[model samples]
Target: MSARVTMKDIAAELGVSINTVHKALTGKAGVSESVRAKVNDKAEEMGYHRNTSASSLRRKDINLVFCLPCASREGAYFYRYLWEGCNRFEQEVIDQGISIERVEFVVGGYADALEHIDERLQVGEKIDGLLAYVPGDDRATHLLEQIAEAGVAIELVDGDRPHFDRLGASLADYSTAGSLMAEQAANLVHASGADARVLLLAGDPYTDSHYLTARAFHNYLRDHNVPWQVEDLTGAHAQVKQLERELKARLSSSEAPELICSVFAVGSELVADTLVSANKAGEVMVIGNDLFPESALALRRGIFTNIVYKDPVGLAYRGAKTLGDYLLWGKTPADPVQKGAVEMVFASNVDRYCKLAGI
Candidate 1:
């Protein structure tokens, strides 16, 4: 029978003590290069299977673990930008000598890579740090606490909660972004000279730092004394059609809103398309959140004045880089890093910064 290789066996072969073998194998500081080299050579000669999992409890590997929510195969357009940014950033960091591996976790469903939280821990992995994009406060908070208690480094990207001490990027800066969008919409309204009212289209208040944007819109309308109304369309197309019909009837009876600020992508596309077909494209100012290609072309045709853009790719790239710095170098970031900055994109520069970053 083949013998099981252990630390004692390697130490005996090298004429060293088990303590020396332990420190050398674990990459712990204080072992001299001469002894570490001798012990490593001897262990490799024996075809030893070092218990890396056991060692990882005491020493972490330089790998990044990324956790995200579940999405369909088609996925969302925003996620695509995020994925591209993370891949590019990971490659760049790897070129700088950081070993990185990404692990994606779905919220409730598990496929091959991650079946459950336990599976996330079992995949031949030792994580030096974690990057989480969990969209829910309650769930992300619970998971982040677990990672921190384990001594694994953590960086929160687009999700916000006070449980984490570090942010890879930030999620709270949406209020400023919201305010910017409102101001742009208002500008478009004034450009139309109060000849048109403004219709604020919104969707899914729970997703993507949206509450801040919605609140900002309300504040802007109040402060400017602009006549506007906010509507929530949770993707019921039939209901949206009904609202559109009613809105159109109101336009016939009185005057139409000069601008439409679509706060979320799904409802924005629908609202924008409806208004365009009604021959109101040139008459109204349209602005919305999170640019997709369709919206990009819309801006080119002057269908939209501006887009309140959030760069997801920047979030992931910066998030991973920040976590890597903290875990490997033991460096801390600026305390209370303000929420991330949002950019306003218009017809002139919309094409350049539309892609977002992700896992």
Candidate 2:
């Protein structure tokens, strides 16, 4: 590493007083624009402005709250990775005197999260920043606005719901992922020498991620001149049996679908099970999203054409680090909207996702 460049060194290089350098760097009134510009340019050239971490240590330790969904067995594997990233980030900044508190939305939706924050406020707790999975809708928006009013910076994980410029987020490009899945499904249909009618199983209605992905997938199929129909399974997450019956009914037609694409991991698993039970696993092409362990196993078993893998762990890690940057040093991400990387997993590379899940 290069020797640490100090404000003193900047002042020396510019042949000015240290006070002038400080004022210029800090946007104070004492320095004239010409001299200020000179000092600023010299400081930039000399790499002198990264004392923020040390400065953070001089201030009070940061207090942040991480809010996320915690359900029974549903979405548990995904949340495990999100928690892993949060825990690892917590350890990374422990020496810097950063404390992260976790608050789970255990029983319900954003309303439960709102109650958690409200309870914190009731106890006179001060939240410096919040790193959470804020849903993309009015309820979450209204609640997040309330939290913003309470003077807490918000960082979104996996999805951006509020559409606020100041809100920090690290998520994946599900739109592109949707198109990729569509492409795979279309190719499978073409290879089968069958008509391109498909069953598109969508996600929860309240989830903008699912809606966005489903829309993109449908658009891609339409643009490619493929025929498909969508059924929004909003209650599938909570009504597993109902979802099963509905899926069975849909796939029970005399003219079997040549392809099936689902926006959610669970949706894909259900389709796989239904197809196997109906003795159509080899007859239909099933394309699914996410790297849930079951989905990975299915991909390896060739029940799935390919599983779209979005790095949720990476999203949580970056989201935590971004919140840390803002809370500890008053820094914001260069791009307020951060997106996660997406990949495709099949039999050839299902092992990578298995190791990621530690299964």
Best by lDDT: 2
Per-residue lDDT value at 154 in model 1: 62
lDDT (Cα, tens digit) per residue for candidate 2, span 223-322: 9777555445555466668888977876787765677788876677787888889776766778887777777777777788887777777788899999
Model 2 residue 140 lDDT?
Answer: 67
Error of 1 at 159 (Å): 2.8
Q: State the lDDT of candidate 1 residue by residue for 189-220, as single tens digits.
A: 66666654556665546665656677777787
The C-alpha TM-scores of every prediction are 0.68, 0.79
- The global Cα lDDT (0 to 1) of model 1 is 0.62
lDDT scores of the candidates, listed in order: 0.62, 0.74
Least accurate 10 contiguous residues by lDDT in model 1: 106-115
